[model samples]
Target: MARFKTKHTEWLLSNMAITVSSLLSSNPKPLTSRPVGRPPIEYVNAGPRQKRKLASDLAVHQGHNTSLLVHAAAVSAEKSNEEDTALVLKNIYLTPSDHNKVRKNLFTQKTDSVRLTEDEAFFEFVLKIAYRLKLKKWQVRDENGKKEMAKQKNTIQKKMWNAMALHVDKPKQNGNGNTNDGNTARRAFAKPKLLAEILGLDENLIAYFNSILIAISCHLPIDPTQFKKYCQKTVTLYMSLYPWFPMSATVHKVLMHGYQIIEASILPLGVLGENASEARNKYYKSDRRLHARKSTRQKNMEDVFHRAMDSSDPLVSSIYLAKRLGQQNKLPLPADVIELLESPNFLYPCNMDNNNNAPVFDANNSDSDSDSENPFTIEIDVEDDF
Candidate 1:
């Protein structure tokens, strides 16, 4: 069973990597073996180490090693001494060549920020603006064609930037069909309350926007069904307000794929999330900016290995070092127990039967009369055409 879960996770990660590569590249290629050495690169901005680190970081942010399933499998496989299972779970044995191919597919040159979904990126934009963070800090130019640093002090500090942006998104145009150059442009920023009222941003709209933020933030319990319903409701509400409202591809994909990930698996959003990967990218960017000659291939390799094998968590570090030292040390807890600890859904009665042969499903025994019927079972009817 552990082997099956591990293999299933690997397959999902592989497929996700491939799908993302196909989307980003015009011509995606299958992963293949190649001679070991520094992989080919078009630029010499930094040495091979920086290139590898950058590539790996990009791949991770795009859901390559971001799968909780893979991590769980790795943990589970370390506990089980079964030779066949060990062989199947030996992913760390991947040659550098194959690993490079996986990274290439999972990331692309076009990627500026790691926010793959539209909604996530949108929220980030709003929050950054609200916090008065300078945009395009890497670049040294603004629209006014001046050398001035782009740091504008926002007098009005608002917590709900997304909600506010909606009110001011559509500006009134002059007779020439362009925004008024002088006073009109400044007035838009002056009276925000009036504009909010004009745009129908009442108490209800503000509440809805707040609710949407809470839903996507994943600060609440990791319930995919509830999350999916929230997403659908928010989208529907937005559409009703403005029928021609544009939605990002990422938003659409979230409704279709994001929630189902939780529904069909034991992993929680926090475990399978992009926060760690995103934070890692930020670290890389900061490190690179601090110096020019810092990104070496050996440095990249050492950093990754250290992060995996020498974690800050004592339990993780202990188990990883034990596995590395080839000692038959018992895991902190059994692999199955680890899964149960990480996921609350598994503790439910539906999955907690102790019987070895608890008939998979008693189809013949219709027990609608029983009060202990499967409360989880849900059904809905749909019409072919309305």
Candidate 2:
């Protein structure tokens, strides 16, 4: 019993010494997670709201990287008066419940900022209306009784003439002439977005926009020759930049007319309106005397699809047949539905079909003449096209 007790005591002391030595030998101390600098409790108390605020800041940083959405926001801002931006910015962050507060706030704000809201944007969009509008020589008279409409592109006098052509033709019963017969004074003035600062009791924003619309009219003479390229580039850029902008019927009609001019005149005259299959048959046949019609068709289709794929519109078919098909009846298709569906391999390459040197079919082929053509003629055409 005495011997066993002595052994147990020796073993217990040895185990404790080993444990102490092991702890001392350990390299990295266990991390107790002490505060790095000041405790977070000294900052905003750690909570779900702090996490959410941090998340919102991160999202805003991401939003800045989204260039297209930022471009849209910039375009929306560009249409307003310098004075109204603060209100616009404030209202932009606000909801419908703040309407009364915003109205009261506008009354307290400066007047210049209160003028020209989206109407200015809409006006600027349709160039002929917003800027230079050609009028009848008799109709182009200024307050000085001279034809200033041609030289004075952006004068209020030009707007007045446009407005007269619009409103006087159909007078309103109200002495104030509030009714729109498709025309009103070319005033860019827009009142406060809220009701309290309104000059008119009715205070319909739509009416105000229409009055600005009336400042522009269908009578504006569009020079088909000079303006076609300008209009095309402008329309393409505008549509590319602002897909969300609400288009008025008048603007659509005008743009349609402009498109019609391009269709009638652009490359091969009257090519755009032709039936796609008919156009393909008439223009793209391998044996077409002047050129390889299929080659041109394929190139045009490729270019148009590349452009239209990036467009926001659903009705995007640059190919004549596809566009016509869309107009006639819709069909099941891919996401890139209207891309080039035809292959040009069968179409004669470089104005030649079968054998490189000789325009003869291989023993394996029978349609020799159908596959081949002379290239010297094709080369001349390409230069002419350029």
Candidate 3:
């Protein structure tokens, strides 16, 4: 009965944090082989300082190449009297010779070519450029660098776990018999603000992370236009920072289609989130164990069903609610969260109370006629069929 739709968003963010941390702690392996005709860019084994200088040089070269392409496109457009910018740009970017070669190799009359879609063809072209540039694979850490990476990874994980401890209760076991203190889903929900400071992440990356947290939050109302703009900026920043990090299907959907989905929903996206249903799972488990009959499987199911129905009954629920105490004061929402919200007033009359004292339901205040009767008691009849 565990719903995964909402949980997946949280998991994605948690996994992303882990992936980024791991990547930052170690070097990545080269993703593609060198293109046969292209000369290898030297300084593969260079230190950080040298790499930074080379990267700057590469940026300058790329800018120069882009300028040349733009100039060529403008000249070609004028000479051919082509008013269609799309066609002109395509023609300029993909030379006739390159197009012919791609058509022959990837889009032929053969069945193999028939299976290759435009997307795949484009990816192949990208792979070629990546190969020429000796770009690293995002996911693969260097095997030889594991010793140093392990040390760094431990340090990072320690910091992350410590930061997580402030918001979430430490789990007894992480399902592998180890007392791994942090729970990914809980951490995602908590959205610790110190992640950037703890990990020493770039400000741009920190902004991207914050945006992602806002996007996935079940409590916040999302504005489609604002979400779209934020999505685009975050995606661009992430790609610029780590071009080798292949966008997973989940991330692709969130970045490309999330705003559309939000716009299509009639209710606030937060209201439609799975938090309420997920919270009921604990109640379900407890009810099954403590209240449900064990005489027969059918009887056990019926008992559980009846108990659930009783709990959900509006009249019954209202009585319990009347006797229930007010909830503990909640912490104020972060500034970024408020900024992304469509209506900040939705969270008006913010709970600024620093008091730790919670209101308690007093038995003397009960409206029921029977003073001795306990409203919280559940009466279960045990069948002695055995």
Best by TM-score: 3
Model 2 per-residue lDDT tens digits across residues 205-255: 323333323222212222344334444554565455344444555455444
TM-score ranking of the models: 3, 1, 2
lDDT at 6, model 3: 69
User: Which prediction has more favorable lDDT, 1 or 3?
Assistant: 3
Over the stretch 1-386, how does candidate 3's per-residue lDDT look in tens digits? 25676667676566433356756667777679767884645676777888989867866877857646665667777677876864645664657556566567666545322332222322232222223222244433667445444455456556656776532223344332223222443343344346545544445555555445545554666788887888888778767865765765556776778789878987766677666788789988898899998899899889988998998876577654533523333454545555566776555434332452222334355453333344465678999998
Q: Give TM-scores for every candidate, taking all chains together and pairing residue i with residue i.
A: 0.29, 0.17, 0.46
- What tens-digit string does per-residue lDDT give for candidate 1 at 1-386? 98888879867666443356546897777779887997666535867888888767766776676445444555667786555654544553434356665577668444344433433343332323332223324233556423232223222222223333422222345323222222332233234454334333433433344343334444224566555666677567656754433444554565456567657755445455666676577555544455324478677656655554444456554444523444433222212222223244443223233553221323244243333322244377987895
lDDT of each: 0.44, 0.39, 0.56
Q: How does model 3 fare in lDDT?
A: 0.56
Mark the 10 consecutive residues where model 3 has the least summed lDDT: 117-126
Tell me which of candidates 2 and 3 scores higher on TM-score. 3
**C-alpha RMSD for every candidate:** 35.8, 24.3, 31.3
> Global lDDT for candidate 1?
0.44
lDDT (Cα, 0-100) at 79 in candidate 1: 80
Task: Return whichever of 1 and 3 wins on TM-score.
Answer: 3
